[model samples]
Target: MLDKLPVVGRFLGGRVADDAGWRRMEALLRKCERRPVYRAWIGDVVVCDATLARRALLDSDNCLAREPSVWQFGDKQRVPAATVTELNRWLHGAAARHDVDAAARIAVVALAAASGDLHRAALLAALDSVADMLGFDCNPELAAAVRVYIGDVFHAKLVNAPLDDAQIARAQGLASRVAALLTTCDADLPAVLRNDGVLTGAARGEVYLHAVLSVVGASAVMLAWLACVLHMDTVAGVDTSADSRAQVFTCKPEHVALELLRLWPPASAHGRRVLKDHQVGPVKALRDDDLVIPVFVLHRHRDTWPDACAFAPQRWHEDPRPAAFMPFSAGPGACIGSQFEIRWLAAVVRQAATLGSLQLVQVGRSPCANTMFSPPRCRLETP
Candidate 1:
């Protein structure tokens, strides 16, 4: 029934991680939240409210585990389970805590190197720096391969399309080279990775392979700071030029960051598969194989956040809803690196403020919707 309306179906089904699509998704989520669980004809079941999103995420009954297709790239291959959990522990727990400050410093250096309209290069470099802490950024060749393969696949997945045969083959070949590089590279790495006995020898190789290869997705978090800068300027009704930097920020950088993270998180959705028949809040999702919680829609819920879609930093001080917020998600599966990403976000904003001003090159445009930002191409200048 819903699919008949081309506009409505596309609006509901589209991944609105990009800036332009966020508002549309936000409105749809608001419209749909009248029911505890909403069904969309465009794709899968969606939960946009905070209460339901939280329950679905922290599902203790094990009714929900990660959707199988998430780790897939252009080829739709299954990432080994051992590889996923190990990288999660190493990247989220070990690397995030140890390297957040380094990520912050890298962000500063990468930002300073930009001369014209911004590109993904700086953000990629900063993300690569985070990878370095994990020993993935060492091989120049492997790093280059990761950039192409990871970026190509992540962008394509949003449209529900896989890359072409040639693209897939290139990614596969590069994946092999990268796997070899990571496992064999002599660079000193984290102790967890060094703990050879934690993994079987073959699984150990795959662990490092995924660690280095996946860095592209891992690093895309910094782009949220771009959205943060643009969002603040739009809300404050000020220009982001050298003379107006003072007017652009109404409060502390952290406060601005918190609000933007609420509205425009780097990662926008979490998906889980139902093991069997189960109920989550208002929705009986057990019938559906896939249950999706959209953080983009979840954060701005009207019931959860009054004045939900509006940019109001002051709300943080007044609201008791912080626990309801899910920028890093909720439950046992929540992102370990969230604090690390937070540091990168806060530091980016503060640094931009100190640098004088920033203005997106596409003045009237929004970024393309994807997992990471199209990392807005912008120009930052000094007064």
Candidate 2:
């Protein structure tokens, strides 16, 4: 994991932290894709082949451990199975009660009214909407705390950078704050988290913290991407009106959302710690080596996807998904809220169609890969 350090990346291979480094890292991955598995840098091994990547990521018996980060709260070891189980439960419950169209409408309205960063507005709207779906009151301060954690602290971990002392302190404090907020705001939380005594003490708090992060963070990021895509399409002279959206995306709104995610997944790569010596195909990995699955490169694998780089929702009409597609990751560690996110994003697409023409107030650019694969700071303008 020390290979993620910018200095190590500068001397060894390529960096993955900022835009300049991300470009080099991505190119390095593409060049190395011919090898099924190879050392990416000093600390990590790259897994490029789809089949090997799946086995490395999905198989429980493979003896690979999840990379520990701030996501684990104070544990700094591994994500607890109980936390994942409870997170899935809470998100699924919210999905069951959520009115997709209504939520989309509200989010779009909030985006339109955004005075500054549309991404932040979309996130706040998502946080509030998820709270409403769960029958809880949304706290503005909590939303701010979440934003700080996602953008500053958690993002550093995602990009494999070290967090500062202030950031580390904030991460701990934020966990406690989220736990207290959940207990106060959501009545069903106790029942959902109790998990037959499995979740108590710090474990319970960890689960609570992740629940809000997953629901609010993932939703807002995807929604921001959706807006960026729509705005670009409109600027490219593609009509984005209701009737045209129906014709352009003949498959369904879900397909459109899938296409957007495929083009710009939020997380650039999924990482795992090799717990034991293993070989997938021709590449052998030793214990403690970091195995990285570059999600962006895999999504664009030419052999698996025809014209792999284009944004074509119609391809989904033929086959909604290919085995290589892993926007949320794969297997047990994959986000359980993926389906819920897709449904909500599809709803946003539907609502956006009614707005006719959409434009990005900021200059058009490729998705930013700093903290995550995100859009440039921009606002949405409907006309």
Candidate 3:
């Protein structure tokens, strides 16, 4: 079935993996580690060699450019360069940690207030709070609308299913309304977007729309991963007191979050459009085609990681950071918000842990999307 799809299909075409994709990826790793470079299709190559994958990712001369894997999944609104720069600037700035934690606190309280489990209502309710922190005029109802469009886009892409006309129209209308709201926000509300660069009229609206959606969507995906990790573990929860809030995350939650990244990186694989022909270790990648590094496969490489298939949080205690760690990718394009995301997710878990240890009811692999977005399905109950 994979062989029937295009080169990119290797990552996108399969039906949801039966076991969070670990079993399928492990089988592929066993086969791929035998060969440094295996052309999955004509021009698309799945680079399995860890050393070479790292080099290809760090290719500083812009030899390997980040390709739009998400766009291929039917998200028509593109994220502009200015929008990315602004969001990056804010997330990496001095106030970033404080701001993210503020947003997380809001989400936690909202999630806890909601009835039922950590389902879609609870997740979007959490995300809308983050949107509000970003200065959006978002309310619970508006947030629900925003989530509907986004959920459709992501779900369609993951399932490799087509969204009907009504679905697309509904999504676009919600997007436009959100864009209009962003356009009217305090002119200096996003000083980073305004002063640091010049984005005007339609461009400004588009950038703001993309940025807001990205923050909400990205946060939801990461939270989903956090849930997945919790489902797999028995991390004891504890209350954050006056003395504990500052230090609570320094302990178990960090290990739990890091292990999550290793096993279910938000983006299972990364794609680069080659700028020039070059040799990485032994593979010579030609230009004008996509070169993919399957992190899903590489992270489980038999020769690289002992007990590659096993989930081991203790490994982080042994080495706080692994050498070939690329859950956030490596080199220049590595996720600029890596530290921010890690701290934020850990804080979320640390807070939730006080309620009870995570009991994974189920781990649902989303219809095969570009990334490993298997949102962990669980019900929070005292164990």
Candidate 4:
């Protein structure tokens, strides 16, 4: 019923996440293409031009960031330097804590158990790795709840939307639960992350959610998309045989990952609140106004990328990484886990190639209904 009203369906979480949803978003964006920046259908100022998009992202004075909200990015009460340092250390060391091949094997079992539900398989696989890093046993129920709370409740907080009393209660409950779980764990933790008064109270939960959830969410979506693209390319004859697929994964996993990010970024669009009146390109903004940059449109802009819409990983061989490439966003609020996630995805992709040829069990998008634009559902089978 809501599908008829794509806009309404999308906002209310009824829109199907698929090619159709993307086309709808594209059509909305096209209406504003003539202007470098203009008010979108949702009333936020949209930046269409890549140059201006960069300016909007980089101009710390003109806009306030929404994420890394715990420590506040581009706002008063900045994220602590020590916190940042420790966090980076923990993230960088995560790879050394677990075996990538073991995670891939877990993913394969998860996929079969889920009947090809890519998100679940990916989430379960990520849980194993994160558990290893944080020195805890994988708790599927807790992991799934964290994913849900982040996607549903915490997202509202990011946007500064008012939650009802029930929602507020739920948020507090989940945070307390998460804090208790992490703080009381007896496993050996990384030095900086050790529970010796290092992380406690809400701060403890905030850091855990930020780091662990980020990995879980990113790994799930990226691996799912990796599977989707492999299957799609195989069906299209771009990957003529299993050997050819394996060759691409073996030789150029990073390039393929980059291409995937360009074509189907998980965070397809990002928004910021206009702090004060400012001019960016032709657009003038008043204080408290909202500005949105549709990374999806920017990636496929004809003027910015040659052969814009094609899923050609080989382009990375000659094409320099464009400024418009912002799968992890940009500026002060950009995802800190971006580099680690990319390398992790690449590692997992290499292992995936050895599993088997992929087949498209289902094709669906999650962006319309969720903040993360995860790829369609698919299956992996030995050919």
The order by descending lDDT is: 2, 4, 3, 1
Number of residue pairs clashing in candidate 3, backbone atoms closer than 3 angstroms, sequence gap of 3 or more or interchain: 2
| lDDT by residue for model 3 (270-364), tens | 67778898776666778876677777666666676777655555567777465556766777667655676677766676665432344435424
lDDT of 3 at 26: 48
Clashing pairs in 4: 17-365
Clashes of 4: 1
lDDT, residue 158, model 1: 35
Find the candidate with the highest TM-score and give its number. 2
Residues 112-131 of candidate 4: C-alpha lDDT, one tens digit per residue: 34544445555655665556
The reply for model 1, stretches above 4 Å from the true place, is 1-27, 67-85, 96-99, 115-119, 150-162, 188-221, 224-250, 318-323, 354-359, 373-383
- lDDT score, candidate 1, position 333: 56
User: How far out, in Å, is residue 82 in model 4?
Assistant: 6.8
Model 1, span 1-383: residue lDDT tens: 00111132234323333344545554556666676566666546677666667877887777776523334434344456775565566666555455555565666556555454344444455555566666656677756655664445434543323467887666556655655555656666544344455543334444454554344343444443443344344421223343333422665666656766776565566666567777666656654466766776667666677777666666766666565587666776566556665666666566554333443344324443344323333444432
Q: Per-residue lDDT for 180-241 in model 2, tens only? A: 55555535554645443545544555556566666666677777766655554441212344
Give, for candidate 1, the lowest lDDT window spanning 10 residues. 1-10
Q: What's model 3's TM-score?
A: 0.74
Judged by lDDT, which candidate is best? 2
Deviation in angstroms for 116 in model 1?
Answer: 6.6
